[model samples]
Target: MHNDTGELVAALDIGGTKIAGALVDGAGRLLARARRATPADGDAATVMGAVAEVLGELLADGRRPRVRAVGIGSAGPVNAAEGTVSPVNVPGWRGFPLVAEVGRLTAGLPVVLVGDGVAMTAAEHWQGAARGRANALCLVVSTGVGGGLVLSGRLHPGPTGNAGHIGHISVDLDGDLCPCGARGCVERIASGPNIARRALETGWRPGPDGDASAAAVAAAARAGDRAALASFARAAQALAAGIAATATLVEIEVAVIGGGVAGAGEVLFAPLRERLRDYATLSFASGVEVLPARLGSDAGLVGAAAAAADACGLWETAGPGGRRH
Candidate 1:
């Protein structure tokens, strides 16, 4: 990492609900950061406009410094070879030429494309919860459920940059339908909106504020609300079964949970671990440790910057978009 010379890299985390930008150092430390709300309609042009606006504001700051590269992590079925992303929640960006477009915004600066879940894994491994760990899974449960893995110290983006997407892993062949047309995908069962939906179905309505988010569910659970607690328990079980399956196949050493749903803390994790223990078919998988993410909200931005810096040879350490090592 010494060769990085502490140059700033622009890191962008484009989620379904919001877009955030940061100037991060070679070490994945944010020098400056900004966030903008994404339009509920989620149009791709509008989303890109928001991204450009945030980047412009970042550049306009008097303290903005020379940039080395740009890194982006978005919801996706990314075409790694093309640096493209197709985030599911942002219906506007299917097959979107993300890397090319972002590169244009950056005036052709070198850019690295990554899935948002994978980006968080990169960030977590670079300097957050998964730091110093050789192999781990970083799962982000928010508007959607997503994940990326670091195995034996390498970032494994799979063939298409959507390697570690545990959300779409079907746990129940007859379970709920996923937007991806799959059955019982963990995302369908555990994501924030879905969790809130479950709470609503269970007769635990958050007031008419339409603020019935996963956080509200967690709050109610903490207050000993039976319906909220039961919903989270099911979500945890579904998520854990998926993680256990991944660990069984790939031998992940740890699973670091993050995002808004994970903010529920033990309400989400305790039962997840218990369920994994109950459902794991292999002995090695039973030992996989689950932990809270350490990076707070900046994991994506820092992870994106980390990926960019590493790809540009600013750092030698590989990030979370690849193998778990």
Candidate 2:
């Protein structure tokens, strides 16, 4: 549906691999967009420069004037209250003031910040698989496993904006130590890189292309590679444990899985669904549904806009000079 409110928000999705920007409307449509490869090894300023470049593209668009606010979805842990982010994968961005910098770049527009997982949840709840669900968990299982919750039909980002970060929750006590100082965390097992690592350790060789990504492993799994299938199965078990734990704690109605690894289709979902039954045995949790994300690559950008629109009351209350009331 078209947004009759004429509300437009600029959105930024910052990850370890890329920086994406878009001008999104209230109806979850992208009016303009831009992206740049993240210089993951660069200093703080250099990383910020890439963000600036993406924003420059949006700013140059003819629709720029109608933009009412800015939204940022950055890899966590993010301090939404303080507008700072310390994403685990982006080492150079410890405690970076992303909101302030984006606000300055956007000429003082109101800027709202949320963890990338929270942003994805907002988008899913607004326009994707979780839209009609009153309680849900949305997960991104790519370079990392990030998640956010929606409860009572609203995004629940917690005080620090990292409420539903299930990636660090220990699923195995004796498992390998995660970078977050935890052992057997979901990300350590279920993340794409970890999936590839496990497949390689178990003697799953990549094809002639030498692409050892989780996608390649998934292809091998589809081709009946035992080692590749085992790796994905292990990842699925970890994911199922995490999802069941979350469902048991929150009574979520559904778990929406997304991101690069999720693109593996049945290679991930078939085992995930089967394993979920093993863990989610409680009556309430057993009824929980698992589904793939529908928003695809645009989820982060759309979610960032959804978060800003929700937080700033863009649809209902506008203060002087188009600022949120």
Candidate 3:
């Protein structure tokens, strides 16, 4: 997979905020890239149009002929078996036939579809923090929470490509209700918006700019705001419970945290690490390591390329199980 074969992967990372496209080489380098803001409130066709526009930019390059396949990492819950996506944030798409649409746009090139979390796992396992680990969990904690798993040294996206969606898992039996209709879900407790909301409810005031985001609460926590600290501690506790449960169930070795919330640095990690000690007490799960993701914002694109490479048979090892459609 490391050798240069002059073959490239056309990668698309579709999210609620943006749609990004790139041409990536076997070595995980992005050659050409394009992006557009997601028309999140628009109709399905409008969203697809944005995706088409991204691909148009990438394909317009002189090296388009070198691209062998297209890989898409979209917000979940995605059905890899059916090549469809129903991202919760993007209301216009419900069971959208994304793979077929991309195939039509790419002139029938092979396309691989995966959940965004799975894509991040592929990127981390292939080249980032989870590299070389036999089993791991990677999480994206932002406005919403999502995750993916790697087990036995390979990405494990499961049948629906959402195996490691830890956010919806209940950590507390009688806590807040999640939009997913579940009570006490990890996302309901630990997502950035929830963190900020909790802080506000507990008497944490915003600055003159009225920035009441989680980042602001994190800064307040760093400055010794009791309410902000308590909010983060609660979020950390919920996240720890979820992570520990996953580690216990699957015997993962590490948990890689990423996305905007993780940018809070020690304000989040310090409490999270301390709380994980209480929940992950089992011998097998006790040694699980937690670390920040290494790839930053480019993870989705790189992971999409990794999935494409795997689908194209360019890897020595099998990737997360899925068929190109």
Candidate 4:
């Protein structure tokens, strides 16, 4: 691929619940945006249709100029080399040809693919929380826990584009059997659904709206419900363990966290900070700092653009040196 083309690129963020698209310029500012709900439960074609709709909206908009390439950050197991994806939450997309499909939709524009976590990391490292940090971990803690790593000042997307998948890392080896066929993974204990599940199982009921989500659980905890508090505490504890493990293994200087569950504010972070003291023991892991993500909901699309920039060589404005695991 040619390096840093200095042109506009189409960016897509595909998740189980939503597909967001945008046109981002050379400097990373979004020029146009579009979105569609993902038909995750539908057949493969149906899901593709939703993505097509998103692309149609962006491409059809008269205000935006034609983009030079397309970048997709998808819920994965994504194979960047093969240009395929198999997201766990979206069952219909096993080995889906996302890159080719998206390329065709955009009139054969060059397409780039990366795991959603890697996309987020790219965004963070480019202009968000991890911008100046040489080593960092960026995490999304919504429906599932996803993560990516930055090492020596560049995003590190390992072979097959799943290197920094911290969500599936086993923290509680003997704890619970996860859907990913792993036992005691960080996601099993720290994802939004898991948090709400633990709270509900512990006798915490939803309020008048009858919404039994992690937000509801957070609200209950804020209202001084002991069960809800306990649930978040447990999730925070697991997250702390996972963060410490990453720090110990890779020597990251910072951990940037984002997503729906992170919206719980201090209710989740307070305990998480407290618990980190217990797990980050080694001297090399002592200074690892945890911070809230700065990009908000736009991280995915922004990161998608950033990953595209990296893949197309548009993100090497600083210097030519880079690394990969």
Candidate 5:
């Protein structure tokens, strides 16, 4: 159902936790959506079944926007060249043929696949906090720390489609070993799970409910827990160093952050902004602004749509009748 006069794109945001689908208009607005919990532990086919279920709902939605193409933003390490994905969190999907499967499911519609981080970058650049910026970095710091870059006003997917993998970038040459076989990577030190792990290891115990998530740690820090505060401070320091390094390496005007750890608000950002001054001492990196992500929960879906729209050659004409690209 391709609409020549009123173009739309089908967008999918696939992660370890959930699979979300949407019909997005030319203006980057979500016209309809569907979601399903991901069966990360299931076999590959079962996991894909969940994705199919989500897509099924979108195709059945009553609004039925004329979907022109399909865009997918999946948890990486994804090989855009080969149309394969092997997200670490979803171990069952090692080297899965995602693009082909999705293409078949969508009746051979043209499809574009990008890492979730890259998709988020697309969303921010199109309609969110990074909107109007020429160069920027967007990060998602949740169960993992991942990022994407918009260099010279375009998304840089690199060859392997993992260009802006800031999480795996080794900030501490002699730091702890990461699951990605790296030493002192940003994700190893700054991810929410790591923050909670560090806090728990340093004699911080959960309350009666015994919830030891990063959110709980943030609450504890807010309640004046020294150990919890220290954990967040450490994570912030790592993030600042990473961000500063990114800015110094490639001049970016802003770094937009989101995800669970970012939900800590100033509990995480206050220290991050303060520490950035120490690491981003060079003139080129000094002016970089760190802003909270504006799209919130919808960033992934919107970003997926943005990617699709870009692929469909609609960015120049697809505005809210007049929204800037």
Candidate 6:
């Protein structure tokens, strides 16, 4: 970055469930972080306010470094050129001017926009599981299933910034309808909501105290719960099918999968591999390797910082030599 003292930046991961923010250095190190419930706030303005609040907190802490810009990894479908986002999961948000809002908070400091999945891939590729790999895919299987692609060692977010939507790929024509109104989508079969649907159909209670999250179901399966185990198996099958399709189409070398739903561990991965083997139609597709993501919560922060650093260009600050200052 800048010798031993790098420039600082604010980063945000705006997902359907929560909004996470962090102050990070040019080296992609998180200096401070905080999160708040996204659903508690209903509209786009409120959500932006929530992000502003976190950024405000980071700035209020005088001990932190000199922050420069703010970067956001928001849920898709976003217009990167215009800096607007309209995520399907968050209907309250419709073409919100992301850069403008964040810029106002940062005193016209640059703001960068990116898809959450794309940001995850950047984080993983830069510092976690996908590091050093040129062609790879990252899929997050949480409230929904989303994917990001890294091709030729660079992030490929596509024109409208909604590419690598692996979950929307249909595996069965007669499968359940998705929120997008499309039939037989992989997410309709394997995402958290669908997994819980599969469980409830088989008479599995999610418990009054706990939500029917993938984490809860995985814990139950590990404890020899039949319905929960079956739900995971079904989800794994869909996951493998989706993985095979992505591999065949993009020829990605490896796939990194994460999110709260992936906590099923081998309970989820083993069957996914086995199912993948069952579905592979050729040798090329069969070569794709699937693994778990290693960045955990930091993926979003690191990626958001990368987006900002990439945008600011002033992030690393050019040194006398060609190297980072």
Expressed as tens digits, the lDDT of each residue in 38-150 for candidate 6 is 76347877877787787788778883447767778888777878889887777878888877888887787778888888788767776778777778889988878888887
Give TM per candidate: 0.89, 0.93, 0.96, 0.92, 0.94, 0.87
Q: Per-residue error at 143 for model 4, in Å?
A: 1.0
lDDT of 4 by residue, 1-325 (tens): 2245447778999988899999887667888888999898999999999999988888886633547778899998899989999988799999999999988887778898989998888888877888778889999999889999988877788877777889998999798999889899999999999999999999999988899999999999999999999999999999999999999999999999998999999999999999999999999997899899988888888888877777766545212235431
10 residues in a row with least lDDT, candidate 4: 316-325
Note the Cα lDDT for every prediction shown: 0.82, 0.90, 0.90, 0.87, 0.87, 0.79
lDDT (0-100) at residue 208 of candidate 2?
93
Give model 4's TM-score versus the native structure. 0.92
Q: Local error of candidate 2 at 95, Å? A: 1.0
Which window of 10 residues has the lowest lDDT sum in candidate 2?
Answer: 316-325
Q: Which structure among the candidates has the greatest lDDT?
A: 3
Candidate closer to the true structure by TM-score (higher is better), 5 or 6: 5
Clashes of 5: 0
Q: Looking at candidate 5, what is the lDDT of residue 140?
A: 93
lDDT of 2 by residue, 140-256 (tens): 999999999988777888987898998998999999999998899999999999999999999999999999999999999999999999999999999999999999999999999
- In candidate 6, the residue pairs with backbone N, CA or C atoms under 3 Å apart (3 or more residues apart, or in different chains) clash, namely 2-325, 3-325
Candidate with maximal TM-score: 3
Instruction: Tell me which of candidates 3 and 4 scores higher on TM-score.
Output: 3
Cα miss at 181, model 2 (Å)?
0.3
lDDT for each residue of candidate 1 in 1-325, tens digit (9 for 90 to 100): 3344557888888876788999887566677888898663767788788888888877677644478788888767778788777766777787878788878887888988888888899888888888877788999998888899888787776776778999999988899888889899999999998888998898997856757888999988989899999999989988988898899889998999998888898888888988888877577877788999989788888888877766677675564344322
Q: Rank the candidates by TM-score, best first.
A: 3, 5, 2, 4, 1, 6
Candidate 3 C-alpha error for residue 14, in Å: 0.7
